[model samples]
Structure formats: C-alpha cells, structure tokens
Target chain A: MSTVVDQPVARAARRRPGALSLGLSRGALELKQFARTRPYLIFTLLFPVLIVLIFGAAFHGDAGGGVSWTQYFVTGMIASGLLATGFQNLAIQIPIERSRGVLKRLVGTPMPRSAYFIGKIVMVLVVSAISTAILLAMAVAFYGLALPDTATKWFTFAWVSLLGVTACTLLGIAYSSLARTGRAAPSMTTPVALVLQFISGVFFVYTGLPGWMQQIAAFFPLKWIAQGLRSVFLPEEFAAREVAHSWELGRVALVLAAWCVAGLILCLLTFRWTDKD
Target chain B: MKTLIRIFRRERAIVDAVTENLAISVRGLRKAYGRTVAVDGLDLAIPRGEVFALLGPNGAGKTTTVEILEGFRRADGGEVRVLGTDPRNATPAWRSRVGIVLQSTGEFEELTVAEVVHHFARYYAGADDPDKVIDRVGLTEKRDARAEKLSGGQKRRLDVALGIIGRPELLFLDEPTTGFDPEARREFWGLIRDLAAAGTTILLTTHYLDEAEALADRVGVIARGRMVALATPAELGDRRNAMATVSWQGPNGPESERTNAPTAVVAALAERFGGEVPGLTVTRPTLEDVYLAMIDKNAISKEEAA
Candidate 1:
C-alpha cells in the first residue's frame, strides 16, 4: 500500500493568485451576501435615513446662522450614517461571523488573511457610500439643502468621509473582540454607537451642547466628521456658530487622521478569529 | 516489548533517511491550557497514502493534537510537520496542499451549495472542478439548494466537497460523520475509501470504534493525552489471538467454555451428541470490547500511580 505519489512537485508548480485580485473577488462575494441579508439592509442603510426624516420634521426653525434645523440635521445624519454602516455594522458582523465559524474556517484556508479584511473594508466603503448618497438625495429633495458650490469643499467632503469611514471600520474590528458570542454582539455594540451619536451632536445642535459634553465629543471622529460635513454644506459665516469660532478644517483633518492611526493600532492588537482558550 | 523497541527503532531510522514519504510526523508534542496538560509527550508518524484513525474519548487531547497539526494553535513544545513542512512555518503553498474538513462549519445559509463550493475553489491554485467535486460527493440533485435547507447528511457531503475541491495531498477529517445516520455513514466510508485509493493521506479522528475499524488502515488509541496502543483493528490488544468462547445447548440448558482450540472442543461435543452440538456458537472479543478494556486498564494504572 505504499503507492505514495510525489504530488508535492506537481502541486508546487501551480501558481497562487495575487492577494489583491482575491481580495476584490472576496469583496464581490461580500456584497452579494450583504444584499441578501434583509436585516442588514433595513438597519444599516434605511434606519439612519428614517431618523433624519423624523428629526427634520420635528425641528422646523433655523438652528442658527441661517442654517435650517433640517439642513443641520441632514449633515449630522451623513456622519451618523457613516458610523452606523462602518462601525456598528462591522462590530456586530465580525462577532457573528466568528461565532458561526466563518472566520475560523477562513483562517485554515490558503486564502491570504489580508484579503478577508480587504473584503470587509471594501464592503463597508460601498455600504457607507450608498447610505451617504441616499441621505444627500433626501436632503436635496425635502430640506432644500444646497450642494457644495466649489471643488475644494467637495474635496473636503471626500476626505472627511473616507477618513471617518476608515477609522470607524478599524475601531469596529477591534471592538468585536469583546463580544464572545453572536447573541451578545448587538447588546454590546449598540449602546456605544448610540452614546457616540448623542454626544457628537448627531441628534442635537453642536453649539447648544454643554461645555463638558462638547469637550468629550471633541476626542472622537464622529464630531469632526459632522463638523467637516457642515463646513462643506453650510455657508462660510456658519463657522461663527461652531464652538471653534472658525471652520477649523485643519484641526478636523488632524483629529480624524489621529483616530485612523489609533484605530488601526487597536485592530492589530485585539483582532482574533476565534474565542480565547 | 522487544517488538515495540524494534518497531520504534525502525521508525526512527526511517525518519532520518527520507521524510518525503511521511505525510505527518510528530515527536514529543506538548500543549497545556494553564495548569491542565492537554497533550503530553505524544508522538505520531503517518506514512504517505495511509488512512490513520485517532480514537479517543472526549477531552482526551484529540482536538488539541489535531489543532496543533492544522496550525490553528501553537504547541508549547514539540516537533511537528505536515506535508514535509513545519506547520508553524507553513506558507500558502503548504496550506494549498492540505485540506481540512472541520468538525462543524459552513453555516453559509444565504449561499447555495454550488456558490459556497465555487467560492472556496478560488483560494486554491490547483482546485478541482467545483461541479464535478459536488457530484462526486453525491450532491448533484441539490446543487442549487441553499446550504441551510440541506439535511444534515447533505450538509456533510457539501463539507466534503469543499474539503476535496483543493485537490489536497493530505486531508484531515475531524469527526466527519458524528451526526450521520447508518446509511449515510456507509456512504461516507465509501467516499473515504475512494479518496484513500486515490493516494490521499487521510487523518481521521472519530469516537466511533466501528468507524475507525471500517475506514482506518491502522488505528491509534489515545487515552489521557498519551498513545496507549497502535495496531490494525483486528489485531488491536492481540484480539486475534485471544481465546474464543464456544457455547452449546446442554441437557440442563446452556453451557460455554473459553479455549484456545475451539475446533477440538466442538468435535468432542459433536461425538458425545452423536450428531451436531445443539445451538453451538463461537465468538471472540469484539473491537469495542478490546478498546474498552484498554481504556479501563489505562485508567486503573493511572489510579495506582496516583
């Protein structure tokens, strides 16, 4: 029974595909899976838009600096949408995948581990972009919100969204380690997400927030995300109504950039494919 | 003891000469979870194209040992190799040559059977045709069905399809048929035999003694994180040479005797009866009986040591 064939030579001759192409393929599969999950669609994409409409209806007067409450809330909704799709979604989804053995199975495969993350990051980007576009459309149709008048302001919007999404996605991956099971994931993550929104002026006026609350929100990316978006969507004089007394675009870029770095570090330190022994 | 020493020396000599023919090799493997020793100084060697079964009770370190070989966990101390490469230093090429049918996986409820298989195929450089692999596992009729909708046996077949799609030289089956019905188990055994015939080195871990006896070319019994016995199923614990029990219907009722020469005993009984021995039967210790004896003896010896 020693009919051992020397298959190593033959198998080694075959070439492995590059990680980037495989990552893209994984991304496509992730999108297909996401589309079929109804709960993810309803909560991640539509739930924030629903909140924006309710808040828009409740506050009819101008918030300050001639920016109507609806417009102010629209900008806040975009920031909140990015956080929900990137942070909230991934924090819950990674734990669920780990609990279901998906991540452990992938760990044993020949697939590059980086490709898995790339696929997830790609999914978050696509979902965030779609939700952002929907919020923008709703703002235009219902709130009489004006588009950014210059390419520079559009550039600001692009960087802010990209930085905010990247930071939140990394943080989500890190936080998923705290959830031991899929059943516990939502209960663990939702409260933190809600607290960030409440404190970061997503559901209220930033200038009206108390000093201690404003100071606390300054440490997080969501605050900077909303402030940056407001700079793009609101008139130039609207800066006076901001707590900073200026647009503070430089500080916004700096704070969000810092979060991206911190989040990546945390993800590297805490990420796991399975429960600890 | 002499035969064991000779066998050990022969295996050690082979290890020094050519490791290419050995699909898996481990020496002095050790692992611990805090103070609990999971695997302690265990050694194993499997030659190429052999189906070897690891039999043990739950928490006997079977999972710890397999996980170490699969590179899912690091060993505290040992030399381990799979497919001629250290799993600790395993590369993508090394990973591509090995397949693992995990004890439980594929909750791909949203994806169809074909989609799940096709998706996994992309990870391997020398993958088999997904459709043909699916058909080989006897899931052709349910190729388009969602994974969650498949019955337990069908789900296991899908797991097998994914395990073989990579055309692995060595495959690890971790309790592959734990939940299978009798008929499904027979079918799964046939699949294993086919894979073995195709020259795939298979390492099977199972709690079922019959499963090990049916599929494994050689079985290794593990107790308390140590390999207590290694032999072919029929020869384990010297069962083939053990005395047989001959039972017959006597004038009183029934009678039986244990003897090394059962044929002579039967002949004598036949002469006394002037024809045939009524209800005569002969039996030897079954594999299960021998396995339980071995485990029980190991436990008693450990108690004595303590």
Candidate 2:
C-alpha cells in the first residue's frame, strides 16, 4: 500500500537550511510581522515624531544661530530615534518573541538560528532610516533649519548616524538577551536609554556637565553616538570636543564595532529561542 | 520463526540501499536534565509512511526526546537520523522537511491565520498552498480572522496547518490533540489520518491510550526512560493471548473464571446449563486495564524504592 506513494518525502524531511538564508528569511519575516502590530508601528514612527515636536517647542524662538536649535535638534532626534528603534525595540521584541515561542518556533525550523538576529538588524536599520527622514523633514520645513552644504558635514552625518545606530543596536541586543520577559524589557531599556540621553549630552552639551559625569559618558557606547551626531550637526568651534582630542572618530568607530562584536558573542551565548525555559 | 527473523533482517539491508524508506531512526539516545536522566539510551526505527505512537506518562522523557529530534535542544548523547540527517546540525533544507506541533501555543495577535501560514511558507523551497492547508485543517471560515480570536481547537488547527504547510516529510505531532474537545479530537484524528495517507511519516506522542489504540499501527510504551514494551495495540498488554473472565448463570449467581482459554470454560458452563447459558459473558483485559496494571506496578515499585 505504501508503494503507491513517495519515498522522497522522508529524505526531504532530513534536510535543514543554511544559517545565512535562515537568518535573512527570519529577519524579513520578523520585520513584516512587526510592521502589522499597531503598537510597534506607533513606537517606531510616532514616538520619534513626538520627540521632535517636544524639542521643537523647547527650541521654538531660537533655531537660526550657527548651531541653531533646529539643526542641533535634528541630529539629537536622529540619534534618539536610532536608540529607540535599535535598543528599545530590540529589547522589547526579543523577550516577547522568546516568551511567545516565536523564537522557539524558528529554532525548530530549518531557518538559520542566526537569521532571527540578522532579521532584527535589518528591521532596526529600516525603521531607523525612516525615522531619520521624518526628523529631517521637521528640521527643514517646520524648524527652518538649513541642510548642510559641505560634503564633510554630510559625511559626518552619515558616519555619526551609522555609529549611533550600530552602537545602540548591539547594546539593545545584548541587553535584550538579559531580559527574561517582554514586559520587563521596556522598564529595563527605558532607564538605560533615559540615563544615556542625559549622559550623552542629548539634552545639554556634555561640556557643561561635571567633568566626571562627562568622562563616565565617554566610556559608554551612547556617548560616542551622541558625540558623532554633534560633530555632524554642531559647528566645529562650539566646544565639547575634549573627550578625545580631534572628535576621536577612529576610537568611537572602534568602540562601537567592539560593542557589536561583544553583542554578537553575548547573543550567541545566552539568547534563547524558545519559551520552554 | 528463524526464517521470518532472517527476512526482517533482510529488510535492514535494503534500508541502507533505499535511503528514503526509513523516515527516522534513533540509536543509543540519551538526555539528562541536571543529575536526573530523562531519555536514556533510547532506540527507535520508524519507517516512511507509517504513524508511530510513543506512549508514555508525564515526565517519561517523551517531550525531551521529541525536542532533541526537533533540534530544539542539544542531546547529551545520541544518534538520531531524522529523514536522513542529524537534527543537531540541521540545514534549512532539512528544517523545511520536518514539521512540529508544540503543546503550548503563543501567537502574533495581529496576524490572520492565512497571513501566518503564508509567512512561514517562504522558508521552504517547496511549500503547500496556505489556503489548501487551512481548508484541510477545517479553518476556512476563520482564515481571515486574527489568530487571537480563534477558539482553542481552531488555534490548534492553525498550529497543525502551519506544521504541514511547509509540506514537511516527517511531522512531529507532540500530543497534538491535547485540550481538544471530543468532536474536535475526532476531527483532528481524521486530519492526522489524511496526512499519514498522503505519505507523511508521523511520530506522535500522546497520553491518551484510547487515541493510541485507535490511531497507531504500533505502540511503544516508555516508562522511566525505558521502552518497556513495543507491539500492536492489541498485543501491548498481551491482550491477544491474555486471560479472560468467563461468567455464566451459577448456583447463587454468575461466577467467573480467569483463564487463557475462555471457550472451554464457556463449553463447560453450556453443559451445566443443558442449553444456552443465561447471562453469559467473556471479556479480556481492555487496553485501559492493561495500562492501569502497568502503571500501578510502577507506582508500587516507586513506593518501595522510596
């Protein structure tokens, strides 16, 4: 009776997919799934827009100076968006997916285990870019901030934003791996984010803060991201470049990359796919 | 008997030649949780296109063993060939070939059944049609509905649908009918039977003896990490040749004898009656009886050990 059917089915059952493909597929799938959720959509797009508006009011009557509030606000807004998307979003999604058995489900599938993390990276990048565009629009139209003309300023913006995104993304991933539940991630991430915002000179320039506080900020990844953003949006002469002699671009990039490396290692070590544990 | 044994061994030779004949094979599998041994040196060979049931109680290591096969957890030691590959290093191609139905289900609250299925299908080179899979699981009306809104049974059906939509070769049905209503259970059974008939090799683990007795070709009873018995449902408790209770109209009432041969006792009773015996009955140990006796014996030993 069995002779009438397939022998290849069992053979097919035995195969598993490559890690890269699995990771890419999982990333795409996660992004698609994440986009459909109303809360996630609001957090990704709306949260940053709200931040821009709040700061827009605070910087209301003064956005035309050499380091105009609008220009300064745009750089900060982009950095914050990257932080929100890369750190907060990751911390929220990982623990929830782990709790929900989404992570576990992927583990059972032939999709590469790393694909899930890779997918998250892709998702954060996409959301961050979109958020950056929205802030840029606000800076240009509502706040009357001029677009940078010098190729160097644009280069600084790109590198600085990349640095922010990279550091925040890795830190988020590392922190999420520590979180046991999705509910706890927001609480855990909010404090680190808020603390980093204060320390990164996001609210006020780091030069004005106490020396020790600024030094402590220099040690953290967020400080470099915020510093990079300042290098892009702020004029070269307003100060706060004392952390490293000449913007410390190389050291910042290296430190951010190191965090990414460390994050990958931690994720591999502790990140669980299933809610079974 | 020796010749029959030789023939069965002969089937083993062809097994290697016809690589696709054996859907899954396990040898010397062991798993331990901390100091407690869960699945110890287990062995199993399930042929392609057969529904094999691994029946055990809670904490019998059924779930652990299944997780190892699903490649969700790393085994301490074992040789497992699922389809034809070791699950621990399973490739995406290998993954697409296997389907798993987990016991606890959590879902994306926003995704419709159709959307979830469609999304999973992209992982496999060859995937079943999402609509067809949904219809097969009897969730056509609920296809557009959000997964969060599905009833318990319907949610399970969606889980089943996702498992099969990959068009997997070997499907791991881990107590698939748990928490299902009787009607829903029956319907799920029908779906399972259909999947088996369509050439899917199913490795089912269930606590329900009735379900196993009804659906399985062969049942392997696992107790404390050991396969204590492996045979057809009727032969599980030696039910085929086991003693039966014979009762008939007696001096006071219907007395009974537990004997291997029920016919002889019934014949003697017929002679005493000098006609058709009133209130005559012959009954063997039911699957449930055998199961209870089997577990009862273990509980007694556990108490002794304590």
Candidate 3:
C-alpha cells in the first residue's frame, strides 16, 4: 500500500511546480479578492497617501534649512510605503488568514502552492507600482525634483525597486511565521520596520552614523534600496562629501539580489501551511 | 441519484466506489507535543462508504488522531493511511481525494459565497458544480452573500459546501452540527445522508451520541488514545444478549428482576398479576446505558491502575 502510494507522489513531485504549471487561475482570483478588500485598498492606496501627507508637513520651506526636504522625503516615502505595504501588511494579513483556517483549507486542495505566493507577489507589485507613481507625482508637483534625461536611470530604478520589493515581501512571509495570532502580527511588524528604519537612514542620513552602524545597516535591504533610489534621482554632477563615495549600480543590484535570495530561503524554511503556532 | 450524478460528466472519481472497504487504515499511530503524549500508539480502521463515528472525552487524543489522519499533523511513531495514502506525506492528488469540514469555519470576509466556491473549485481536477454543492448544502439563495454574513448554521453548511466542492472520496466531518438548532441539525443530517447515499465515505467525530446513532453505521469509543470499543449500534456491548429488566407490580408494591429469559419471567409474573401483569415492563439496555456503563468501567479500571 505504501509503495503504491509513494510511486504516484514521487512521479508527480519529480517535476514539481515548473514555471508554467506554478500559477493557477485561483491566483488571479485571490489577487482580485485581495485587491477589493477595504483594508487592502486602504493600505495599498490610501495609507501611503496618508503617510506622505503627514511627512509633507516636515518638508515645508519654513521647516529646517529649507534644503528642499521633499526631494529627500520622496525617496524615504517610497522606501517606507513599499516596505509598509509589502512586509508589514503581509505579516498581519497572513496570520489572520491562517487563524481563519483559510490557509488550512488551501493546503487540503490541489491548488499549486506557488499560486498562493504568486497572488501575493502580484498584489505587492500592483500596490508598489501605484504607490510609486503617486509618490513620484507628489514629488514632481510640489518638490519640482527632476530625473535623468535618458531611460537608462528609469530602467535601473525599476529593477532595483523590484528586487527590493521581493526581498521585503519574502522577509514579511518569514516574519509572519513568528506571529502567534493575527492581531499580534501588526504590532510585531511595527518594531521590526521601525528598527530597520532607524538603522537604515529612514529617519536620518546613514553617512553621519558610526562605522559599525553603517556596516550593520548595509545588511538591511532597505538601506541599499533607499541609497539606490537616491543615486537615481539625485543629480549626477552633485559634489561628493566622501573621497571614495560612488554609487556602483552593480553592488546595489547584487545586494538586493542577495537579500531576496536569503529572504526567500527563510520564508520557505519557516512557513507553516497550518496554524501550528 | 444515478441519473442526477451522470449529468456531471466532468466529475471523475467523485464517489468512493468502495464495497464495504476501509476508508482509513491506521496502524500503531503515535504523536507527542513535547513530553505530553497526545496520541499514544493508537489505531483505527474506518470502512469506506460508511459513516463511522469516533467518540471520546476531552484529552482522549480524538482531535490529534484526526488531524494526523487529515495530514494536518505528523505522527512521530507509526504508519497511518487515509484513503490508501500515508497521511504523513500527503500530496495534492491525495488531498484532492479527501474533504474536511472542521468546527472552525474558513472565512474570506471580502469574497461572496459564489466567488469563494468558484475560486476553490479550481484546486481540484474534477470538482462538483459550485451551484449544485451550495444548493445541496441548502445555501442556494445566499450564493451571493459573503461567508461572514451567514448565520452560525449557515456558516457550518458553507464550510461543508467548501469541503465537498472538490468531490472528495473521503470526508472528515468534525463536529459538523455542534451549534445547529434541532431543525438545522436534522437538515444537516439529511445532507450527510444524501452524501452517504452517493457512496462518499464519511468519518464523523461528534460529541452528540444521538447524532452518531443516527448517522454512523458503526461507532468506536476511544479512551486515552486507545479504542476501547468498536461495533454497530445494536451489537455494541452485550446489547443483543444483555438481560432485560422485568418489573411488575405485586401485592407488596412493585418487584423487579434481571433475567436473560424475559419471556419466562413475564409468564411467571402474569400468574401473580392475574390475566395481565399490572405495570409490567420488560426493558432492555439502551444505547445511552451501554455507553455510560462502558465509560464508567473504563474510568474505574483507570483509577485502579493508578
């Protein structure tokens, strides 16, 4: 009986979840349902708008040295909003679904397991794209910040941002495994995001920090993500503060890739199909 | 039923084509949650195409055993098979062949009933029609309603609807009618009976004994992870040969006697009461009586062992 059962499963799994076979129609369905949700709608569209509005208060001409904080604030907002939507939202949403036995139900079906993640990844991308566009609009309208004349900078920015999103999203899935309940996940997301924000120069410049802090913050994908964005929008002819300071696009790409690889591995390692916690 | 089922040509291997076969064949199953032995060397064999009920008190490892069989949890030390597949290493194909209606409802607050069912329908290769499954579970009118908007009983029926939407060979119903009213329970019972008649194997675990008697072809009582008894309703305990308590009113109030030969006892009592034995009763042991006695005996033996 065991051999009879093992043979089919072995044959099926021998070529498990190929690129084409991975995505199911259910993934499209899940994305649609997730997009229509009130919380999802608010987090994806409204929450970022709210965060930008609140931070916009700090960017007024009268505030500080009037260094056009909007230019700097734009990148920070992009970093903050993407992380919040992808990582923070997922951590809480996943636990709630698990608690509701939704995950359990899905595990019992023949639905390709990758379909579950592909749906979330698609939602993250859509939400990130919308948020990025709105942030860019806000930056252009009020801050009057300009971009490179050529399309190369935009292409580089897009690739870097996508890599960062993958890292953040996969890490969110990994962090969600620690949450015991749905309500607890939101609270847990805050501290992790806030701590990363503090160390990764979301609140201040990473250059002013100690060497140890810089070394540590370098490991955080958000730090490179924000830095990578800064390199894109910031003037190429701008005076360099440090002697050896240069934005190596390859390093930025490599770091983001490494983070994504690490995050995906962690997520796969710790994720539970049921509410084992 | 045959004519109605034939209409669903797309539904392949929908019913359990079993002939008095075993749905679940567990051998020496064991599980533990860190020093606490949840299921200690337990075993069960439920027949296919039959409603087999598992009854046990709290902490008797009923849920753990069922979860292990459902492939939700792994057993540490034993081989366990459900619908001919080892549940420890459950696959999508194996999963597609089984259905589970748990007490806790799976809710997607945003999606309407039709949406949720239609979405889940893609998971199985040859699934039942979403509309028909919803209608069968008696939620046809509320097909557009969100799952959370449904009443408690309706929610349970929705759970059942989702569970059976895949057209599973074996269905595990854990306390399916816990919160149902009498009428709702009867309606749920009717749905269960309909599924049973369709040749779908059902393994129901319910605290309600009457529900078991009404649904199960056979019932097994598990105590501390051990199946203490397994038999049909009429054959359980000494139900067939157990002494009938013959009681009758004599000149001195009432007299009672326990006897296997109840006819002879009734004949003798007739002489005392003249033509008819006044207030005569020849009562046999009921299901409840046997159940209580069995459990009580187990408790006493346990205490003695301790």
- Which one is best on lDDT? 1
Against the true two-chain complex, what DockQ does each candidate achieve? 0.56, 0.35, 0.25
Q: Please identify model 1 stretches exceeding 4 Å from their true place.
A: A2-9, A12-14, B1-16, B248-256, B268-279
Q: Fraction of native contacts in model 1?
A: 0.54
In Å, residue B112's CA in model 1 sits off its true spot by 1.2
Across residues A162-249, which tens digit of lDDT does each residue of candidate 1 receive? 9989989988888888899988999999998899898998888887889999999999999999999999999999999888788799
TM-score per prediction, in order, is: 0.93, 0.83, 0.85
Once all C-alphas are superposed, what RMSD does model 1 give against the true structure? 4.7
Worst 10 residues of 1 chain A by lDDT: A4-13
Higher-scoring candidate on TM-score, 1 or 2: 1
> DockQ (C-alpha) of model 3?
0.25
Off by over 4 Å in 3: A1-24, A62-67, A208-212, A238-244, B1-20, B243-285
- Winner on DockQ between 1 and 2 is 1
> Tens digit of lDDT per residue, candidate 2, span B142-230?
88898888888888888888888788878998888878999999999998888888888888998888898878877887777767778
lDDT by residue (B167-211, candidate 1, tens digit) is: 988999989997899998998999999888888999999989999
Regarding TM-score, does 1 or 3 come out ahead? 1
| CA RMSD of each candidate after superposition | 4.7, 5.8, 8.0
lDDT of 2 by residue, A37-65 (tens): 87878877887778777777776453322
Quality of candidate 2 docking, DockQ: 0.35
